[model samples]
Target: MRQPRKSTVEIRTSFRGREAIVSGAAAALFRREKEGGFFGISVKLHARVRLKVIVVNSVEYRPDVDCYIRVPDPSNATAVAQGFAPRRCHVDDFS
Candidate 1:
């Protein structure tokens, strides 16, 4: 397993207060803390001037696949609250 080097991400995710383990990104040698379905990373972009990029929304992960996926609105608390939890699947439900 690869640990994050000087690079890391930590977000306070709360699904009844728990953690989102990013074993998938771990392959990419990146580790992060997931909370409210968001992970924060600290990086340095050296430039004569300054550069700023922004993430204005939430992030979600799929532990079943060990990766992050895009969602319409990650701010859905009831859904995002499933961090590090077993997914509730229905045989009739397919998305």
Candidate 2:
């Protein structure tokens, strides 16, 4: 007999100091898989600049894992416009 797949929950949160909320699956929050990768949320801040936010699960071999939000710095709009990498923001697990 084969084991059943685990059920996933929806996670929603707003970017650092942003009004928009990004939502994704609980299992593959910020992981990229070969079979079914989690899709990231995209938001446009300026006329020529857009940002993508994803929740990355960085726990290895652990029962309780922590998640983080990867997004561009809202304060550094000019740097983001100049094509810089997004920073990782820590997420608090209240459950």
Candidate 3:
């Protein structure tokens, strides 16, 4: 069998409620178009990259600033792991 080709997209997201960074590699984020030229991209983050996490709520230290982070989807992860980033590693196993 052949591994499916992967696509990478950078997504700055807030996880667990705190200002954190998570790099994810995704397989597919299907898109659909609607009337009036409206579209949506559904992204399911990859699970290979190690991430720093935090948890917060509307009561405890609510964040007002938008955070920025890198995404390492299979393709991006493969790229980064293959010395694509400034400093890179080999993505042998994202397990």
Candidate 4:
């Protein structure tokens, strides 16, 4: 039998000057709209060492590593604010 296909999105994020890939359903949350609208999702990292993260939309994010963050969607703030919560991400979480 064929294996079920996983629905995932790819997001290019950087940390500490190094580029990394974040892939999965969560990544889809960071996808930018087609009309060149507001920046994609907002991520805030909390780590001992300061790091810089570059998202797919060319927006720069500098949050602590291993910090829980709520993905911000400007288009639908109320929905995202109500539905999502701050989530933690580890270094290994990025590919």
Give the top-scoring candidate (lDDT). Answer: 4
Measured with C-alpha atoms, the lDDT of residue 13 in candidate 2 is 58
Candidate 1, residues 7-79, lDDT tens digits: the string is 6665454335256444676533422232334443332222122223353433332222122332222555754
- Candidate 1 to truth, TM: 0.19
Residue 3's lDDT within candidate 1 is: 34
Model 3 scores worst on lDDT over the 10 consecutive residues at: 27-36
Consecutive 10-residue window with the lowest summed lDDT within model 4: 32-41
TM-score order, best first, reads 4, 2, 1, 3
lDDT by residue for model 2 over 17-55, one digit each (tens)?
Answer: 334334566434434421222234543221121222354
Clashing pairs in 2: none
Residue-by-residue lDDT tens digits, candidate 4, 31-83: 53312333344455442322334433333344444444444344665654566
Q: Global lDDT for candidate 3?
A: 0.32
- Using all chains and alpha carbons, the TM-scores for the candidates as numbered come to 0.19, 0.21, 0.18, 0.21
Consecutive 10-residue window with the lowest summed lDDT within model 1: 43-52
The residue-by-residue lDDT of candidate 3 on 1-95, one tens digit each, is: 22223645554654343543333332122111212122232333333222323443223222222223233333344434644232232332333
Give the residue spans of candidate 1 off by over 4 A. 1-32, 49-95
For each candidate, C-alpha RMSD in Å?
20.4, 19.5, 19.3, 19.3
Off by over 4 Å in 2: 1-7, 15-62, 68-70, 78-95
Residue 33 miss distance in model 1 (angstroms): 2.5
